[model samples]
Each structure stands twice: as structure tokens, then as C-alpha cells.
Target chain A: MSGLTPREWLGLEATHNPHRWYLPVIPRLSVREIFLFGGAGLAAATTALEETTERPVVWATAQYLDFAKVGETMDLDVHVSVSGRYTTQARVIGRVGDREIITVNAALGRRELDLTETWPTPPDVRSPDACRPRGYDYDQDSLGKHLDQRFAPTTGKKLGGPTGHGPGRLCVWTKPPDGVGNSAATLAVFGDFVPMGISNVASQPVGSNSLDNTLRIIDVRPSEWYLLDIEAGGIANGFGHGQLRIWDDQGNLQAIASQSVVVRDRLKR
Target chain B: MSGLTPREWLGLEATHNPHRWYLPVIPRLSVREIFLFGGAGLAAATTALEETTERPVVWATAQYLDFAKVGETMDLDVHVSVSGRYTTQARVIGRVGDREIITVNAALGRRELDLTETWPTPPDVRSPDACRPRGYDYDQDSLGKHLDQRFAPTTGKKLGGPTGHGPGRLCVWTKPPDGVGNSAATLAVFGDFVPMGISNVASQPVGSNSLDNTLRIIDVRPSEWYLLDIEAGGIANGFGHGQLRIWDDQGNLQAIASQSVVVRDRLKR
Candidate 1:
């Protein structure tokens, strides 16, 4: 069965410069069907560098400046700022025409050492079998359509949970389509769900436009399901800040993700 | 008496190119009087751009590539990646000669909005007055001398503390010299102390050399004392990951910072 490659999902194309790439903003990878979601752009940039340097991205932080609407193309220019024996620090600029949309800086490399520990134990929640699936319907109106989501018992309560009102935490079991594979880039895409928590906790239709998304990749292992543990911390001055922990099905901490978003109160509008 | 301006402390010199500034690595700013501390570089880069753009840095992340020693100088090249009416996204590269030492990406601007909230409450720890002062002495061998650190009651238990032997959390009240004003740049410096928590929680003498430090500025209020609530999480594959929340004395969440570090065991050596 032939299907689209992960690169195709990202709409990444090769450029004359090996360090640079061209990516298209397609609906399949967009959040609101209007612009490229923060995660998709992060995935494309890191994936391109992962393929180029043949190293895993240890940490990458992308500061989103503007948006690339569906049908727009972004030119990703990657630069290896410094190359060391065990690590390489790099930067990528994603632009559409003369307008820059996203700028990402990353550290890529792997070293072998004998220290390992994961602090937060996964909360004992019902398995995906017991949870309700969300955002799986292939709808152009929502970015959730691209992933399979099962709301854990702790998921935003007002939206249909064992509900709560204040900014607390949410947990969900989610996974991309089977074709995406297990990679740091995939982790980046899944790690962009903190905004969902913001809306969920608000219990009202609130919109959040992320100013920046930072992902720190801890470990990448093959797993069909990943759990998102999101904590919505503070909201002030029309902005919200939160942190998310991405864990595989086996409860292994894979990455720590954080974001700050510009809040849009739909009720006010 | 007129003190040296913030720019003078940063030693930022004007370049023929308006977009570029030169910075010197001085002992007063060095962590151990050798190489430039992570926070100093971050401060210099952001201060330079803050002066040029006449805006405050909202978020800045720096990936440490190499060290700029006490006599060496770095050229900070700033670029305005995107400029919006109320915000500007920019990147800065700090290089010594042809070698890149630090790369920083930041968001700068101030907007008027009516939403405000701070979630994380300050942990009930001993005040700086009740806690023991650390790194207060001007010691050339330690980074502590640069800041006044008062270990909260939860500080290292095993490395001669109340004695615990597992990865845990540490909280401290820390502040830069009185001469340094409280700005986002000052927060950046205080947020670079995860390495201390690593050593505190490890029990033994271990060193965590950070690969990158990312600071998400939440609020930059003028305060003499800032609290660092650091959680030292996973340690594996010879690396460690941790997150810190910066709070002002009034229990306001100022910034969320995280880092990944290369772990070194002095016992093994």
C-alpha cells in the first residue's frame, strides 16, 4: 500500500542548497485551515535538519513571527552555526517571499553516557480504550483532524470531562497517522497542544495564537500512542504561558514542551 | 555618583554596521572568571538589541556553542527577522573571531491588552534572610559570587544538606548586584542556575554543562529579589533536563526557563 511520505505531509521540498529547504503550507497540516500550525512548521524544519545532519534534535525553540496561510510556500534556510564532535548547533529561517514567518534554533547531536532518570511518573489514567476520541474526523476546520486524540479522564473538564473551571492541567492520549513514524519531528508536532489546554480550561471558545513553541526532545522510541500532559500556568496581559510533557504509551517521558500564546477571547468578540 | 550604564557593563561597542555590536567578556561577568557565563552573553546580546530597537526583550533563548574567555570579545550581529506594529522577532549571533559562541533568538515589543493572571504560587520556603547565603563571596572559582544566593530550606540535602539521595527540586532567592537593574536580562542571568540544582539533587559533586538555555520572559517588574524555583527532572544518556520558574518577591511568575545539560561526575574523575 503506497501512501504519502512524512516529507509530503510536511510539504518539504529540496532546494539547491543542501542546508535549505522549501515547505508548503497545506491544509492537511494546518490548525485552523487558515495558516500553518506552529507544530507543523517546527516538524518540517527539524526533520529537514535531522535528515541533513543525520542527528537527532536535542532541543529546538521556534519563535513565530507571522503566519503562512494554506497554499503559501515557506523557504526554510538552515545554517549550522557551530559543529562540534558530539553536537551541532543550527538555525533555520522559514519565510514566504520577503516576509519571515518562523525562526528556529536547535541543537542536534547524540552522546553516550551512563546517567538516566525520568522524574514525573505518568498519572494512572484509563487507557485509550476507555476514553472518547476527539478531532479524528478529517475536517478542514480543525487541526485536530490530523491526529487521533482520546481525552483522558483529566482532559479539560468543561468540554465534557469530569469538568473543572480554572487553569490546571489536562491529559490526552494522541498519535499521528501510522506513516509519520517515530522521530523527534513527530514529537515536535504532538508537543504543540498546550493551546488546547488553554481553551479547554477556559471552558469557553477562546483562541490562542502562539508567539513561540519550544521543544526539548528527551528520548524517541517507537510507539503507537503518546500521552500529552499539559499544564496551563499563567495568563496575563493578553498572553498565556504553559508547559507540556510528551510521553510514549509506556509512560516514558519523551520531551518537555512549553509555549506562550496570545489569547483571544471569543466571548469578547 | 554616576554608575556605568547597562551598556557599559555589557561592554557593547558600536560597529560601523548599525545592526552589529561588539561585546567584551570581562571577569566581573564571567561565571568562574574564565569563560563568559551563559547569562552574561544573553544579557549582552539582548541589551545591545534592546538599545538599538528601543524595546524590551520578551523572550530570548541562547544555545551555547563555545566559551568567550575573560579577555576575548564577541561581535553580536542582530537581525530583525520580522517587524510588526507592536512586536519584532529578531535573532542575534555572538561570535568570537570566526567561531560562534552563542546564538540568541528573541521577541521584542510591548502591546496594550487587558488580560492578566499568574498561576504558580510561590512555594512556602524560608525567606532570603532566614536562609543561608551562598555565592555571596567574590570567589574566582565559582559562579555563585556573581549573585547573592540564599538557599531555600529545600536545597541540597545530601551534598551536606539535610541529606537526601535522589533527584529533586531546589529553590533559592537570588539577585544580581545592586548596581544591576531588574530587567528581563537580569532574569535571564538568575535563571541560569539549574546546574546548582543538579549538583544539589545529585548528592555527589557533579557538573552540568548546559548546551542551551531558553528563557521565556513573562513580566519584567523592578524588584530587588527574585526567586528561582527549579525542578531537576530526568538524567539519562549522560545528559540532564530541568525546568525553572522565576518569580518576584510578590509571588508573580516572571519567566519560565528550561535547559539541557551534559552531566559530568567528579567522582568518576
Candidate 2:
């Protein structure tokens, strides 16, 4: 363990100003060392929001406006719109120089109530130890390489393989590197896998550029592995929509995420 | 039919500045004449963004910061963050005087692609004609009065009634008064039903103050009635989460909405 928070692992730097934060786009934060990963950008914004408000994130939605390529620095400006006794509503706009990269609106804080319940049951799947390590077509130093992922038994064929047309759903167990604890920022990184689930649904070498990602936190608990139960709702008009239910290894529901992505066909190398 | 567009029906007026719009929170636009309906506020923002960007909204998410009560006027400021060749990323910040009420981030425009499909099948329920009108415990002059809703066959009990502990799901056929049409803004207005669905899930006299609502448009087609398939995901730490699937009578998926609300216990008179 690096004894670093998820924010530190992302290399998010704090300026003297409480409302301003900076993130340098390193190769580990990029996709294929080309551009910043969408989830990492959101995680950066989320980290800033939580820090500025001094409250845990309850929910956050990020709209991807542009790309911040590797080697660029993103400046995040946090704006607190409303700060009530129980909750704080804020937003963060990230830009590289003059180009806007992402906008995130979030609600933070909590309320005391006696009611607590969850309705959705976690999918029945083998433990992460019983599953095989997930393989990636592109072997590059990027965000995906830092995490350990295993496909559950339900995921019949590996990605980029042939499959019968079925309900667009995939289950995978993921464990981040040692220092990345069960923080909301860490879950934001895992929530960006909806585009990958879309590829399985389409049965092709197709992925997406996310237009927006919305994450709703239920309960974040520490566990060795988290199951990403992803289901693609549909694809139409060159856009695909899907959602993910994150479950800890102890069968605790942690968070829920939904996203809309711009569908793009990938050329097989 | 009043022949007014959904924007006009909401009383959204264009200001001298191209990036500014105004909405008067009249009783018809409010909930129980208390505050602006959460969905109506989002609809107003969607209208402003659509007019300013001249692009159909692909998806929009709104975070409710404060309440704009009846008799207040909301000023919406539209900001275009990035305008790409085929898509535009923008946001609308609505304020009542000096208090910020809502912040909406959206992506708009369309792309030309032949790929189109919807995987989730609509629930098997009786047609709207065969269903009974949904009864509201509180009769007031508000937005709910303007919408004609019918409980689907699966919805066995009405609000504030006893229900067997089962999966937290409800379906209702809703038809807005004439002239609403099938615009993205109209869908925004209907997408705010997640809070109502939570009441059914808890099997108690409970509702919520919305924290955020996110809507993703799939295919908007005009129909007399739209089926709102709502399912409550869970409730924990004084917050509830749920999602909705809107379908036209023709079995076409119209849109998908997800929301997080601060759960509140309603008093029975």
C-alpha cells in the first residue's frame, strides 16, 4: 500500500485557493497513453468537490465536453451553488488551458434516518478467485492496467470474441491497486465500464466515447473485490445507454451508475 | 390543442439576450402550489439549451440546488461549453433572484448511423384503455393535475395504501394534456416520477425531495399515452434511488431516466 488516498494516486494537486485544483494527465491516467480516461477526469472533479465542500459525495454527474490528452494539465474550478445544513450542491468545471474538458455537478453530505434497505439482489456468480483474469486487446500502460479484473462465469466469451445474441449484460469482478480504498472516487473510475459492456452487447469490436456518466452512491464498504453488474439498455441513433450496479464481495450494494455514450466502431488491428 | 410548443406551455419566454430565458413559476408549474415541480424546472432548462444550441438533446441531467416557489421568476442562463461538428455540450443555470435553483448539463445533436436497436422489452400489461385512472390523495392545482395518468395492471395498490412486500416496481400510463407533443423537453417533464415510485417501494406514506434527475432520450415518437415503468433501486442513509423507462403505446422506447431523492415521510391527514 502506498498509504495514499485515491486523489493522491491520481496525482491531484491542491492549490492555495480552496476552490481550485490541478491534475496532470499522466500515462497511468490516460487511455492507451492517448487521452485522459473519462472516469479519471470525473474522479478528479469529484475529489475536488468533496475537498471543497468538506462532505462526502452523495451523487455526481459528469458531462464530457472534450479530451485532455496525456501530458496536459487540467485545472478544475469548484463552485458551491448551495450549502445547506445537511447537503451541499456544487459543480466543477475542468479545462486544459482554454478548452473545456469536463463539467461535473454533485451533491454531498448525508442525513440521519432510521430507514435503510436495498431491493435489488446481487447476481449469483463465482468468487473472483475462481474466475480467470480478464484480457485486454490493447496491451498498453493506461488506467485499465492498474486494476485487476476477472470475468464471472456468466461472461461466456472474452471481449472481441464471437457470441450469441442475448441480453446485453456482463459481470466482472474488479480490484483496484492496494492504496485505492473503497472511496467514491475509486468507484467513479469503475463506473466508466459501461462502454465496455456495450461492446459485449453489440457482439462486435465496438466501444463508445461517453457523453455523460451519472453516479449515485448508496453505501461504500471496504471489500477485496467489487462486482460490476453491467447491463446495456439499448443502442439507437448512434448512441448507447447502460447502467451498472456495483456490489462488494460481501454482497453489499455500494453504488449505481448510468451513462450514455457515443457509439463508435473500433478497427481490429 | 393550444397549438403552443411544450416550451410555450411551460411559459418559458425568450429574453433580449440569446443566452437568457425566463420562466414564471405559476401554480400550474408547481407542486401543490408550494414549489416549482422538479421536472418542470429541468424542462425549462432543456428548452433554453435547445433554443440556444439549436440541437436536440441527447441527454440532460439536472441537480436540484434550491427550490423556486410559486410566484417566483426563474432566470435561466445558457452556456455552451463545446460545440463540436455533430454534438454540443452545454449547461443551464437557473436562479430565482440571487438563489441558484438548478444546474443542468446536457449534450445535444445527432449523428448519422444505421445501427439501431432496443434490447429491453416493455412489460406485459393491459392497454391504457383497460386501466383505471390513477387516484391522487391530494387534489390540487399543480402539474400533476395537468397529466392524465392510469395505473397499469401490475400496480395493484394506489399510493398511501397497503401493499405486499414485493419488488419495488410500478407502471403507469401517462398522457399530458394536448399540445405537449413528444419533444425532449416533454420527456424531461415526465422523467421526474422517480420520487413518486419510491413511495410505492416503501409501502408507506412517503415521498422525496429530488436531489438530481438524469434523462437520456432514445427515440421520441408521439403517442396518446406513454407508459412510465419505474423501479426503486434502494434507499439508504436518508436517500432513495430509482430509474424509469418511458415507452410509447406503440412499444417504442422513448427515454430513460434515473434519479436520487432525499426520502421524506409524508403525514397522513
Candidate 3:
């Protein structure tokens, strides 16, 4: 966390051209050492866009098209479609060699306005220190190992565990080793938990592949631990949809994200 | 509805090339007779992508960058990034001349799976016929004129009315002149109600312009009147965020949409 930019933390390298960036898919940036994690890919693209535009991201949506393996590299090309006085519309297309892997569309910039209010209250839960550590089946070489997660008391089931019929809601306190210090890219990485919540709601160890991930920023503040309040909207026809409200320790809403995933049974994997 | 496809219904004219489409922004396709409606623009893009890919839309997201005023023609260019056996990844870049107005990225196709489930249930409300007709203050030359809207009994307030501080939820029954016949594009048009819901939650006659609209289709069935259950997420820094769950008369979830908008005082307009 020593004044390191998110691009440096994610091992994203800058080219001589301002609109181009690349990330080597190291083990820490991948999922189970198999492919680039969806959130990590999104974070890489976000960092690249922010660096090129020199603006804070307001909203970004990334669609996962293919996979970049652990040893491959993802090259991102930034395109600025419109640059307004107060906002900019841009996109980043990431590819490994000639094969496209991800496409991220985003808006970045801020307007000076007086109004500010948040209505959704955070769930009353114990602090991260009081919660039990979350358990996962993946090895240490995956992206999940880089995050420290704790299940709230309201979380009806543990990861890869059974659950009873309920409202399909899960609350978890997550923290990275270096902390999310006012970086939207860091929060984007944590926003990938919707798939975990989907499995909890299904009452089975279900595996999901995200087709799209959208992050809507309300406000980003430096915080050590953030709460991920995940709720499953619905699951139908082999697809699952859900949303998460990320909150700082003081109960301030940081960002809201929603995603749709392709659901499959874990046994098949 | 006749034998009209969604492209035909939206007046999207196809060019000799398969990847090109255009829409003349008529009053019925605009808002306030001033600019193209955000959802209509998205629906136009979705229609173009579907027509080009020859597939059903699973999810589509559009980022509104600029305005396409009434009487203007929007030209859409469809790009298929990946055409898999069961799913296709594509995007539509829409513009009025050289000004980019909207960008829509989508995934389309369906898979045969033995599993199907929907966790979120529709709210218990009276039939559409039992509700009072919704009132609006706009003229006849707008998209709102084509929609028949009814205030649900659970709705605490009407459009442009005062409201008590609550959870910021509004339910309404809306029907187009022609029913939504398994068309995701038609449902995309209805997904633009987040701004209206924002005004209701604020208890003021506020105005909002959409920045991004994301639609995730779960199941679509033909129905006369569809229920729009809108919930306001939060408002901060002159930006409003909200989501909606669209349901048919039979209580089946048709789609879920989330949006972010720039908030303004209606008095200024």
C-alpha cells in the first residue's frame, strides 16, 4: 500500500502509448490458477481507463467473452467515444494476442453538486473481528486467497455448504491485505461475490461463470473492511441474476453492482 | 401487434448491409418531444443486435452518451465479437451523424438445461383493472402517451406528487397499446422508469436523465398488462440509482433492470 497505484498492484504495465496497457496473468491475478478472475479482469480494465482518462470512474460494465489463462497476458486498448465538460464515455477492449477476452464500457468524471443522500441502510452485523472466517475449497494460488473474508451472523450458510429456503441474502465482510484506499478498481475486484451468493441461495455447491459484471459507483472512501450485502434477484433457465451493495465500515454506501452468471452444478467441475 | 417484429414495431429500418440499422426519432419514440427516450434508444440497439445475430437477447446494457433529438435519425452499427454455438457476444454503436449517442453491449442465445427456478416472488397487489389510471403532465407528443399506466394500491404516491419518507418503493401496472409478446426489446422500453421512481422517492418534482441502463432477461411471456416494481437504491452527489423488477400479469418475472441517472430539479426545466 506504499503509495502504489492500482495499476502497479495488479501488475499492469504501461506502454509508450497512453491508451494501451497490458497485464500478465500471474497466479495472484487468476482464479484457481486456471483463468483470469472476472473481477480482476474488470479491475485491470478500470485501472487502464482511469489512467488514460485521468478521471474517476462513475460506472463501468464488463462483459467476459473468453478466458486468458494463467501464463497469458491481456492487452487492453482504451477508446474514448465522448469527452464532455463533466463526464467522459469510454471503453476498453482486452485481448490475449488476437483473441478477445473482455470488453468494458465506462463513464468517468465528477460534477459539482450539492445534493447527497443514501437511503438503503446497512444490515446490523458484528464487526469483521467478531465474525468467523469464511472457508473455501480452492487452493492458495487463486484470487480468493488474496482476500480475507468473514461471514456475518446473518449468512445462513458457509461457502460450498447447504442452505434452507430463505430470501437469498448473504452478508460478508471482506478486506484485502493492503486495504481498499479510495480505489474503485479495488472495489470492483470484490464485486465478484455475486456468484458466491447465488450458490448460497441455491442450497447446493453450484459453480457459476459470469457473463457480465456491472459496477455503479455512488461514493468511494478509504476503508479497511467493507461489507458486501449480496442478494439474489432470481435464478431461472440455467442463469442466475443478483446484486450487491458495498458499504464502508461506517455504513456508507460505496458502490452497487449487479451481475448475471451461467449456473452449473459443482459436481460437473 | 399484427405480424410486426420488434424491429418493425420500433420503426428500425434495415439497410442493405446486415450490420446496419437506423431509426427516425419520432415523437412516439422520444421523451418530452425533445430528445430520444433512453430506453427507446436501447431498445433500438437491442433490436439491431438481435436482427444481426438471429438470436434471443439474454442481457443488454446501454450507456447514454448524448442526445438524439426528435426528427433525428440514429444509425446503428452492429459488431459481433464472438459467435459461439449457443451464445453470441456483440455490441451496437449508435450515432446521429458523427456524434455517438449510445453504446449497447449484449449476449444472446439460450441453452437447454433441466434446471429452472425463480426465487423472487411478485408482490401481492390488486389487478390492473382495479387500480387508478396514472396521470402525467406532459403533452401528447411523447412516448408516455403511448403507455397506459395505473397506480398500484401499494404505491404511496402518484407521479410528481409528495410522499412520506419510506423505503422508496413504487409499484405500478403499465400496458402498451400492443402487448409485450416475448420481446426483450419491448421490455427494455419499460425499463426506463427508474428516473420516474427517483422523483417519487425524493418527494419532489425532480427530473432525471439516464446515464446507463442495464437489462437482464430471465423469462418472457405474453401478457396484456405488466407490473413495474421500482425501488430506489440511493441518491448522492446529484446522481440517482435504482432498479426495477418487471412482471407479467400471471406473477412471472419477465426481466430485471438497473439504472443510474443525473438528477435535477424539475423547476429548472
lDDT of 3 by residue, B1-269 (tens): 43567776689999999999999998888888899989999999988988899988888999998999998999999999889877888999999999989999998887655556666767666788888887777665778777888767643333322222246777778887563355887789889998878887775567788889999998878888888888788776667888888999999988999998878867655
Best by lDDT: 2
TM-score of each: 0.89, 0.93, 0.92
Backbone N/Cα/C clashes per model = 10, 0, 0
Q: Rank the candidates by DockQ, best first.
A: 2, 3, 1
DockQ of each: 0.53, 0.74, 0.63
Across A75-103, the per-residue lDDT of candidate 2 in tens digits comes to 99999988888888889989999888999
Q: For candidate 1, write residues A171-249 as lDDT tens digits.
A: 8889776466677778888878889877776545678888888988888877878888887777755667788899888
Flag clash pairs in model 1: A115-B236, A116-B235, A116-B236, A117-B235, A157-A163, A235-B117, A236-B116, A236-B117, A237-B115, B157-B163
Give residue B234's error in model 2 in angstroms. 1.4
Which 10-residue window of candidate 2 chain B scores lowest in summed lDDT? Answer: B156-165
lDDT digits (tens) for residues B50-153 of candidate 1: 87778777778888888998889999999888777777778898999998898888877766655566555666666688888874445574445757888777
Question: In model 2 chain A, where is the ten-residue run with the lowest total lDDT?
Answer: A157-166
lDDT of 2 by residue, B1-269 (tens): 43668677899999899899999999988899999999999999988998989888889999998899999999999999888888888899899998889999998888766678777777766788888887668867789888888777643333421122237777888997667778887899889999878887785567688999899999989888998888788888878998899999988989999999988767632
Q: Relative to the unseen true structure, what is the C-alpha lDDT of residue B208 in candidate 2, on a scale of 0 to 100? A: 88
Could you tell me which 10 consecutive residues in candidate 3 chain B have the lowest summed lDDT?
B156-165
After superposition, which runs of candidate 3 have C-alpha atoms over 4 Å from their true positions?
A: A1-3, A155-165, B1-3, B155-165, B203-205, B267-269
lDDT of 3 by residue, A43-77 (tens): 99999999999988888999999999999999999
